[model samples]
Target: MKRSMVLVAVLVVLLGIYWLMQSNRPMTDPDRPFVQIDTAQVTSLRIESSTDTVELARRGDQWFLTKPLEFPTAARMTDQALGRLGEMRKLTLVTDRPDRFREFQVDDSTGVKVSVTDRKKTHTFYLGKTSPTAGTSYARLDGSKEVWEIAGNMTPAFKRPVRDWRDKTISEADREGFIKFTFVYPKETISATLVDSVWKVEAGAEKFDADKNQISRVTGLLSRMSGVDFADTLAADAFDAPECHLIAELALGETLDLRLIPKGEDGSQYFLRKAGAPTDYVIYKSTAEVLMRKAADLRPKPEKSAEAPPQKPRG
Candidate 1:
């Protein structure tokens, strides 16, 4: 009986060792990518879909779209895209049936293809349909037959239109250090400068008091302004600049020339344009109203009469 028990113990020990070895084996497979690539070396990225193809390349410190129009692309958005792809890992092997590429939207003709090139080599993959979870996408490495669910969304990042890819920043200067402004109107031109944190009015319209509150208010407006979108097809002869044209010359050597043009006779809507822009942006009249005042509007309102003018009582 003792001999029989000893044999059973040896058999159990052998089974435990076999299980441990299988469990300790690496999860990564030679045929698959268990992790993503480093993005520091990525010099160019090309995204292709059935409808369009967009390309972004690094030039020194900035990233630019090379095709559809060579322009500066949004920096943060570009970096976020590359970072998300770098974090991709094969979540699951989704090939359960044969000829199932179309069902996953990962077929060669239907998928969104992303190609990244570094100084050394290029890596390419196809982005299929997004997963139901909304955080992941179906992907297949170039030349690989298997499809995977990677942990990122690469569709919207690379599929923007030309105007959408252009630098949409109307102003990028720090608001605190702005020191000067030059506003030009039909009747008058006002130039205001900052000295020792106090605003000094250099020139203004006739009878204009250079009201401190109003001048400061105009200066404050610059901080809140930004470009809403590109006016790609603004008509050349569509502006009427009789109201006000403002030029804010900042300490950073940046100048913005904004003009207000009411749309129609009723003046319900307005159109605005800068000096050198090929297009004009449509804005509401209220947005440009502060800059469209005559000298009377900038003066302090009249208070109650201290000593009434009593001579003209009978007339």
Candidate 2:
């Protein structure tokens, strides 16, 4: 072969090898694993910081907070964390020096450790400070020295306190096919019944129009009623002599009974209790008013005619 041709061939081979090395580099690999454990198979998880530790376990499909407090953890948040962990990809390697772990916030004394266990396998990693852009976070596998920036800021999910992790739902019930609804006020009691999916006043002081819109508004409110937080510390008897009561008896063999006790002389808030509920919950004054409406309040107001003002007859 010619000397110039041989030199050109050697240069081409060198460039090809360099490209291959760059392609296989960790930062460039697209399929890098962040947590290494399959989210669907994760049976339990533990998150530990210098001062606190949060433990969780999965039963069937629900995630429960077992440590720091034993309660059902919000499944939505837990699932979101698992999803982010599985989806995170390597961005860049930050450090490998043991002495620099403190600076990166991955040291045992400062860093937060998250571990997930499957049936027999387990995966654990430590998370550090997020990048300036807040788009990626620094992470390192347990027992490994290398620290790499991983996609997503992972702190939001695992660093939350027990209250933030718990399920805040107060109740879950369908409003359709409600057979009976009763409003018991201090002065009077109003009862309504549904026959063949139609609602009418069963008993009251006087006759009523059985306004559908008012009924619907109340139904919608009840359907979406959820507690802002749990007040399990409050005693159930505190609501025994409620100022008002709203009872919804459904055709589905379900009954929802809510009693509202005025919180203060102003009645701007209340300690709400549901029959058979383990704890009482707090609700805003406006919310209590909506739920504890009197029969008169449910009547739709009449609309005035939009006819033009009377004009003089060609005077």
Candidate 3:
């Protein structure tokens, strides 16, 4: 019984020691430092890569891309970057010595740095273990020196303006004036004028039909001139096509030679002139629905002509 008691006591002591060691074991190694990021607080961000540079600004609860003044940032890209940054905050620092954290590199360089600034303070992060998948590389944030890894790929979240050019607004005063329509080709020139309810074409020789429905559409389009959306902006290659060039040349004037001059008391005078045209038509901008309308409106109204009196026949 004495021998058994001694063995039991030894076992109990050993178990206590084992329990103490297990309890005291560090979650992370002291030589390595782990970092966590709080992405929610990040208000604005700027990223520079070999191919492009992007700036992202936060407005209210939305994010916007400020550069290029055109393309808006994608929502998924913004959410992912923010989520990753937030996840960084959960990391625990395992190192007291900064030199031990030097093994990790961000952006494939010896030192990659990321500097995050909020309303109150700025925090810097470095890069550590990197797991690259597909075209993107993911790495641990070491210190500011290693941020370059993710910096190039980081995109800012931004609210972009709608690109519907058809819904733009135009001022009433703008419509009050006449808009001169002048069509000029290499060998031919055509001119038209728009007035309140009348459309004069062919230098006042012909009239155009101006009805209520036609005037509304033209006026509405002119008023809402918010401009074209970036995505709608014509691509260089598309414009470079021979057919496109021909279309543009035929549409817009080669020079400002073909002019639409708007004038009159209420700015209602529209004068259309081609480069060498002898005469111009003055009309209201709102009068013409299309070229055909101008032609119809220009038709001369019947005039009462003076006639010899009947008394002359009796005499």
Best-fitting candidate, scored by TM-score:
2
- The positional error of residue 81 in candidate 1, measured at the CA in angstroms, is 1.1
**Candidate 2 residue-wise lDDT at 57:** 95
In candidate 2, stretches whose alpha carbon ends up further than 4 angstroms from where it belongs are: 1-29, 264-268, 309-315
Kindly list the per-residue Cα lDDT of model 2 for residues 1-315, writing each as its tens digit. 699999999999999999987665435355777656678888998998887799999999889989977888877889887887677687777889999888878878878898889887888888888887676778888998998888778877787776777886665657565677899877788877776666677445575656777777677777768666667777646866788888988777888899988776887777788888655777888878777767677665788879998898895
What TM-score does model 1 achieve against the real structure?
0.69
Ten consecutive residues with minimal summed lDDT in candidate 2?
A: 21-30
Q: TM-score for every candidate vs. truth?
A: 0.69, 0.82, 0.31
lDDT of 1 at 300: 63
Better of 1 and 3 by TM-score: 1
List clashing residue pairs in candidate 1: none
- Using lDDT as the measure, the top candidate is 2
Going through the candidates in order, what is the number of backbone clashes in each? 0, 0, 48
Sort the predicted structures by TM-score, highest score first.
2, 1, 3
> Per-model C-alpha lDDT, please?
0.69, 0.78, 0.41
Q: Write down the lDDT that model 1 would get.
A: 0.69
Predicted structure 3, TM vs. truth: 0.31
Which portions of model 3 miss their true places by more than 4 Å?
1-37, 68-71, 89-104, 107-113, 126-129, 132-315
